[model samples]
Target: MKILTIDTGTTNTRITLWRDGKAVSVAATQVGVRDTAITGSRSKLDEAVRDTIAAALEKGRTTADDVDLVLASGMITSNVGLHEIPHVLAPAGIADLARGMESELLPHIFSKPIWFVPGVRNDVENIGLHNCEEMDMMRGEEVEVMGLIERLSLRGPAMLIMPGSHSKFVCIDENNQITGCVTTLSGELLHIITHNTILADSLDRDFATEINPEMLLAGAELAKRIGLGRACFNVRTLDQFTIYQRNDRANFLLGAVLGADLLTLKNSNAIRMRPGIDVIIAGKPILKQALALLVQNDDYFSGDVTVVPDDLQPQLAGLGAIAVARARKLVTP
Candidate 1:
């Protein structure tokens, strides 16, 4: 049977078609509506969603009716997308996520069968005894992670990090069940610093060419001194140097921002998973460099780091896996 999966993220929307236990076709588009004003003004996002699915279907030589199952994860079920479903708290298994989706978000999408993966949540206290709830949610990419795991028939505790607007570190135990996870604001911070903050104009749009060790070190040191609020301005202030030196400065600035995110994740008790674990860094190509930089700088351990090719869209893999599991009744409804 063929399955269609949709992953709507903060910056993009992706669709994938799977058949006979393999991905047959895929399509992606930048459909994320991070700005409240833009999301309110237009159904452009909805149109993009339709277009992405259409492209996938065309490439896969299939239609919506041909799909036996449909699965979705990400912001698509939030107040912003086709529906608004609140997150189901964690210590949750695949069954819980499947059931939650079946009951809450599926009825509107398709009557045949549909699944929505719920985000994981945990409330923990540490350091100052502050009560904080860390929610690890996936809208579209949940299907991708599940699909990848299913394809590999992986049976062990594995850590998967989906880095983007909201970076998530998801943990799956040996039974192929999601145990617990953490979310970081790395992507949002990058967007805010580069676009909204005064630093936007100071840095080049192409960040890939501007990264280096010296810049990373300087950025990390500056962040430690002034914090994120003041660091945003330093990007512009440090731009007085020659063009050759500007790249290093930009790299440092970016590194510091990413470092802050890693520090937050490291300190939070919400992410209590063991160290020296296998990590799958999923997302765009630039993320590979970012992950490498993080490790090189000792932001996170470097051992056993596997960078999954961005070729297979995570949402598609996830939705296709859900569809297959649902078809066999392997996943509880």
Candidate 2:
């Protein structure tokens, strides 16, 4: 069976085509939609979505009619997306997300049957820490995380951290059920402080910023002591004197923010690991480094840690996972 999956995120739109459960082609495009705060960008968003899907289809030498199933997740269903499908609360799984898609209101541009996966939400005490209400509505990465977990056959009490603009830590039980999770705005926060805020001018554009270990460690320590807001101020001050010139400074700042996030998880007692337990880190390389630092922290180290580079075509992983769910009748066609 041929399946096409789309993952429309804030920064980009990605599509992947799968043949008999293996990815054959994939494509991505920068999002043209601006002002995601309103519905006016819907036209542009729809265009971007179609363009990405069309490109993927072309690369795979297939047409929409050739696709046996279509699946999608991400902001595509938010008010800012092509549709405004509401979120289904947790511990709702893929089944609930698929069911929600059946009733989802979509724009006329989509002629194929598309399944929109809904994010999980809860109002628990930790909700305030990560804005659970907001994080409650994840899109494409949820399936990717679940797929990676299943692919690894990870068993019993696993913690999966997916880092990006909005990082998330998802806890799974032995049955691959999501029991609890937390989200952090570390990526977006870093972007804002370094680019849009006062620190932009001082940042060395050419510096291999991600690998600067000194900056990572400093960032971690600063965040541990002064907190995120104050940490930003410190970066700005150091930038003035070229203190940030030391490659280590940037690494510290990065580490500080990530460490703070890990600290929150630690406080919540969310880092549980038994014998043969696994920690799956999924995301871009820089964020992966931050996660690696966390895993190496003496306070948190227990089980084996495995970092999975996001697959060449993450949308395929997501789509394949959904396909598995559908084949098992966990979700309706």
Instruction: Indicate which candidate wins on lDDT.
Output: 2
lDDT of 1 by residue, 1-333 (tens): 687777776677777787855678989997765532364843676577667877998999887778776666777767676555666555555565566674333333344455555554553335243545453455544555666675556555777777777777777776766666777788777877766666666766435364576777667667767886677567776786546365665686677777676666556566665666666667777666676567556645644767776665444445444644574474444
TM-score of each: 0.76, 0.82
lDDT score for residue 163 of model 1? 75
Instruction: Give the 10-residue window scoring lowest on summed lDDT in candidate 1.
Output: 102-111
Give model 2's clash tally: 16
Q: Of the candidates shown, which would achieve the greatest TM-score relative to the real structure?
A: 2
lDDT of each: 0.64, 0.65
- Give lDDT: candidate 1, residue 211: 52
lDDT of prediction 2: 0.65
Off by over 4 Å in 2: 32-36, 39-41, 94-108, 123-135, 205-215, 236-246, 268-278, 310-313, 324-333
